[model samples]
Target chain A: MQLTERHRKYWRANLRLTGTLLAIWFAVTFGVVWFARELADIKFLNFPLPFWVGAQGALIVYVLLVRHYARRMNELDEEYGVAEDGR
Target chain B: MSRAFANRIKKYYSFYTGAFVMFVLALAVAEYMGMPDQWIGWTFMAATVALYAGIGIVSRTADVTEYYVAGRRVPAIFNGMATGADWMSAASFIGMAGTLYAKGYDGLAFVMGWTGGYVLVALLLAPYLRKFGQFTIPDFMGARYGGHTARTIAVAGTILASFTYVTAQIYGVGIITSRFLGITFEIGVFVGLAGLLVCSFLGGMRAVTWTQVAQYIILIIAYLMPVVFMSYQVTSMPVPQLVYGTVLEKVTEREEEIMADPAQATARDAYRARAEEIGRAIAALEASGSNGESLAQLRRDKETAEAKARPIHHHAEPFPGETEAERDTARLNFIALTFCLMVGTASLPHVLIRFYTTPSVREARESVFWSLFFIFLLYFTAPAYAVFAKYEVYTNLIGSSIVELPGWVASWAKLGLVKVEDINGDGILQLAELTLNPDVIVLATPEIAGLPYVVAGLVAAGGLAAALSTADGLLLTIANALSHDVYYQMIDRQASTTRRLAVSKGLLLLVALIAAYVASLKPDTILSMVAWAFSIAAACFFPALVLGIFWQRATREGAIAGMLVGLGVTLFYLVGVKFYGMTKWLGITDVSAGIFGIPAGFVTIWLVSLFTPAPDRATLELVERVRYPSLRG
Candidate 1:
């Protein structure tokens, strides 16, 4: 149960990656969605900015966040020698 | 390719081939026999039942692992599709656009909240839960907390959340069947229940998974077809997804024009006048101590008058916030709703169980991405559909003569989904006179666009698929939670796999019957019930599940206390505000009821854990292992 340096390093790296992604998540989900009204004066692709963010923009950002997290985590797993082999 | 892969491909090929052949035959019969619209609806319903029944029979399995977790062998892509179908219940497929149509900007809470939760799922829950290798959410709860009490609390939460959700799905099925097949709502509930049970009972998760993939196909096609046609008709653009932007502009422009028009102003004034007259009459009668059928009739008359006036108010000022205070409330409600949905989505037992079916932690994460991608195909289109459908109502139906209104209007009106009355005796359908239920928007889209009757039937089938797919997943979750977590693990730990499977299947039937009966009673609106389900899940499970994964210091006492407190606050707030109408007590509306429970739950968990002794070293190591999959025990 003792934590090795390797375990600490791996945990740190994972937390760091998750933190960065979650920050972006907070920005996209809460920041954009909540402050959308302020950006309403600006229009995007013929729709109001707030409307565009609520309808399409926020969702796209969420998908990218997930994809980025998955890709980075998978790489982290490999670097840490924790990746599961295809059974 | 492996034999199972080849067999899956062949199985799908034959299934699609058979479905296509049956569809064409049904079309031909409709054309040749000149079948009525009701018969067309019946044919669609029958085809769906047969297809799901066929898949269930084909995938029938006796292996307990397969029944419980689809043998943990589902590939990411197919699992993603099945999960997509499982995630998008009747609310997403049918009621979502209708909500958008009715609420406008406020509806984005659902749009953003439901989809954003997938990010939380991929980041926080799915991979670790898959690594834990549990059959159900309660399994994780019981294992991590190491007790019957934690497991039982989880079972209670799961049943409460999933049962409410399954009832809503069944209600959606009843609505769809009654509208399409011209059957009574009660019969529709039983029919939909029968279809749901047939697929789920035969093979459990294994059958449900394949059936859901097939449903994803039907629902997406059914959902997109009408909107695509409507978009092309309005904007002369084939891609409704892109063209809806232009439609929004046009609709806004039309709204302004209607607001400015003197005729519309006069009609609005007349509606207002009538509403005020009824209001005063009711008040005067009450003041005079009138307390008989006449007073009740006056109240009913006032309700009808207000209903007639509401659309005019909408046409005049669509969004909720006409004033600054209203805007703040709307904004607060929107954020609160989205937060609740995100937490609820991540906590849902039925959804998390899908992750357990994936082969690896990586695949579980990958499947979350795919689930979101598939769900986005529908979510992104929902707003566009709302825009076009609203435009259709605003531009054409608002001013048309009642006699000249389309056949679909009469049919929908007969079902009380759309009510058009010339309150002022002006043969022309004024905006004030049209009271359209949000549920009718998607159903009427095909007819409003002048599409073939067959396409309407297809939409009905798609709705049925959406309802049935979610119901199957929900039933399985409840059944598994009861059988595995409650019966086998807690009551009789030495039970055989065969005995467990039988108990699970039996529980599935029992739960489905109870859900159908409740759905037949029809407690609330589909969207409202769906929203309440999210609040319940958010309060009951979100804190415990999230903290269990991340905070190593979290003790079993803290978790149990957190869940109980969270669920208790939510139920109290919900019942107090919703059933008892005690909104003033907590200043919490039904939509924002989770505001009270979620934060209280998190604080309780944190505070309780800080005071309690740290969990045993073995439990800490288990948490570490779950966090770092590379770590060896």
Candidate 2:
């Protein structure tokens, strides 16, 4: 398992981005749930505010996080001299 | 025949076709004997036991990995089948339909959330975890965080989540048993335990996986048959929700007529006279300027009056009572339960584990599409059966003057599986008038639709399939945590695989006992309990897992902080709010509000990770190694 300077930078960036996104994730879940009534007045694409957050918003974030992680991990693999196949 | 040709012929015929034939034959024989649907449930219980016995004769590996993960060489297709079996437990097959039946449109959240959780597993968690995989969820936590503390916390969380979830499955078994076997609830639990022990403990993972795959097929077919038959009968539409909604229109009309015709109804004079007595007593209270007490009395009288007037039906929803607020509360609770179900589906562990079975990341992605396709087959039919059953109750069984029900009803009632009571004393059975358990909606489908005896038998077989498959998968995970993660990795790193396998088998037995014990204690509801488990998982694992995969600088301290805070918040909202009241604990009025737990976890993880130093270059390389499977084990 060889690690180069490029790997270090990529890893650092990945960590920072993950941390930021996660913080936002928490805010969305707790904030919207606590203020469901207030948010329910707001709608996205015709869904009630709370319903949008609960059903659609949470799912979209999950997809973004997954794509973000997969791409970052692939980049880190390239820098570290480890092939994507782990050969 | 040529040797090569014979082998090819034998391969397809022997394994796949033979098993299919045996299952069909068993089903046919059970149906033929007039053994009833409840007795048909035994076919699954028998098949699972028989499958385990066969696995024991074929495999003799003493290696722990062999027992825990089948030496990690399971073919992708076989693994997918097993995973399907693992994912579609009793809750999915039995409880889901009933919920949709009772809740209506709001229940889509459950189906969507559950299937969507697989997407998270495929792209985000599974491949990487498989790359880094050793045994248990705690193993990943311990390795990523680099410590015994992280591992210990992960293990505790897994146990908490797994144990709570498994208890619900056990409770399901008990309910099914009491319904099918003419047995006491205690005996039902015991019967469920005995079957689980044979399917899981006797064979360990090696046996459990294969058996689970079989169970999945049985359960899925069982779940589908009744819904399909019912859908065909009503509206000729195969879609479940449409059938349910269509029946809703019919039921609403009947209810309206009953409400209007109460004044001129000739039947139920006895109950109507009693209701008048109660109604007058309440009217006197209202005349005395006692609004609060008078309202309570009036509400009770209303129930009595509705019962008398609607003596021809059984399962009526409570009428619009005195207070608008109370009616709104019922509607609100229905909405909240639906929300909990949808969100919680994304957080289940056993379901998450299924994605790991796929060989490539792409395959994982495709498999989910297949799963959703397979799931939709029954999912669309569920509401149909639910509504059809409700309509059956309303139309025929409610207030009819027949002391004995029609053949199917009498038969099911004789099994004590579907009980009835003459609530309004009209001597007629109103099927809709019965207070049906949500769990029984799918289970009771064959009887409700007046399907052939064999169809009813098939329905029972399906419930058993769903229950046992899920039980086996959960038991295997629990066993791995004890044997591979705790005993081998943490306590004794140098322990031989053979010794570890022994411990894993022992743990399987112990956990099965514990689950059986917990199931006997009985919880509030299977669906709600499942939600509690999921919310706890989302609070604890989802954040940590997401962060671990994407963030290279995620510190041990940060991960730990995030998990603790998230779990604490989820628990406070779930248990604390229930016991202490939301006002005293968090000053929040709505219990459906998950409060601050999810965000609290995310923040704690991020801030703590930032404050701590990043992983060393060596650990970063390990992360790289795990990301790519061809990088070498």
Candidate 3:
């Protein structure tokens, strides 16, 4: 039950990664969607920026956020000697 | 992938592909044999139900663990597909494009909120819950909080949220069944309910999961085929997903042109003249001091006149806000709606439970990624469907002579789904003369484009698949909560596995019957009811589940208190503002009731935890174990 230095390091790394990814999540979802109207004045690939972002860009970003979190968490698990054996 | 995993994928792939090919051949034969449209629709409905029922029967198992969690052996990719089907209910499949067609940019709240919530699921809940490895969400609550009281509260929240959600799905089933089978809506509810019970009650979660995978295939194909065909028709481009940007630009240009046309201006003037006449008539009735019945009659007439006039005045535009205050409210509404939906998606019990069926924590994470990937296939195509459907309507239908309008319009008008009155007496379809229920857009698309009648039947089957897949998952969640969480765990405490499984099956039937009766009543539109369900889930369960995993200091008392307050406040606000027309509290509407309840729950849990004693050492250790899998006992 005792918390060791190794556990503390793994936990801190996980939290930091989670925090950073969440910030990006907030920026893409809320930040981009809220300012979508202002971004409409700009065009991307011949489509309105906000429209393209709202319709497609935000979702792709969300998928990447999840994929990154999974890969990083797996790395953290292995580094801390806690990874599943893939039974 | 491992050899075993690859083989499982190949097995299911070959099975589904064979089934799909056979169904297509049957449909082709039916068409070539010159079956009537009614017969074709009935055949599609019957064949699909038979296919699902067959899968359910084959996968049926009486083992308690398998019944509850599919034996926790589902491969990641397959689980992801099943979850995607469960997640994309009737609201996503049937109503999403219609909403986009009607609301334009504002409706992207649904798109963003739903898909974005997967991130929250992957990071905040699914992996840890999978590591906990419980049969149900309430099981985690009970063990983590160390008492039956927490479990009971958690069960109550799950039932309330799941029941509301399942009712909407059942309502969607009724709509699809009645429209396709040419039966009454009540009859459709019973038929759909029968299909739902057979698929869910026979094998429980095991049957439902496999059936859901098959349903996902049907729904995705049914949804994409018409839209892709339409896209090609419009832009000579085969990829609707890529070509829609040009369609959107064209739609905007056409809207601007229509707004400036003199013909539109004349139609608007005529609509205004009718509205003025109605207003004068209403004033005359009021001035004469007519009786209440006559006054009511006059008001109804006025409403009819206005309904006929409004669309001409505001056709196919983003939510119109003439003032700064109104614009601000619209923006706030958009943000509030999206935030609530995101949290709600993460907190839904049925969705959360799907993660528990994954084989490991890593697979749980992978499953979330695949679920979003499968869902994106549909979400990416929805806006294109809306744009192309709108383009078709704006270019071809509006301004056509009423007699020359497409045959589908007359047929749909007969069913009251589309209305055309030729209000200007020009014998032509003015924009004002035409109105449509948004639900019919997806259903009517194939016919509008003059595709084979069988495509319409295929679309109906797809809609049914969407509704039934979600219903199966939700019904199982409610049944498990009742039989496992309450009956065996709380009441008996010594029930055998067989007995528990039997009880769960019985409870599933009872719940399905009740949901069907509610669906028969036709309570609300599919999307609105779904929104309400999401708000309830977000408000009640989101805080407890998220904080329980992340915040080691969170106590049982705090969790229990937060759940009760959150559920109570959300239900109170929704019932008050929505049903009774009470003024919104803090300018927050019922759809975003979570705006008030979520924070209250989070703050209450944090504040109360700060003042209370810390949880026992064992409980803290369990939290650590859930957080770090290597430490699991």
Judging by TM-score against the true structure, name the best candidate.
Answer: 3
- TM-score of chain B, per candidate? 0.93, 0.79, 0.94
Per-model TM-score, in order, reads 0.94, 0.75, 0.94
Model 3, B467-515: lDDT tens per residue? 9999999999999999999999999999888888889888999999998
Clashes per model (N, Cα, C within 3 A): 0, 32, 0
Residue runs of model 1 more than 4 Å from their true location after superposition: B1-36, B284-319, B525-528, B583-588
Candidate 2 lDDT by residue in tens digits, B75-169: 44456566777777687787876765565434544654554455445555676777675666777788888888878777777777777677777
The model with the greater DockQ, 1 or 3, is: 3
Candidates, ranked, lDDT: 3, 1, 2
Candidate 2 is scored at a TM of: 0.75
C-alpha DockQ of every model: 0.58, 0.11, 0.59
Better TM-score candidate (2, 3): 3
The share of true interface contacts that also appear in candidate 2 amounts to 0.10
Interface RMSDs of all predictions?
3.0, 8.1, 2.6
| Model 2 CA deviation exceeding 4 Å by range | A1-87, B1-44, B56-60, B236-347, B360-362, B368-372, B394-433, B521-530, B584-595, B628-633
lDDT of 3 at B611: 84
Compared with the true structure, model 1 gives a TM-score of 0.94
Candidate number that wins on TM-score, 1 or 2: 1
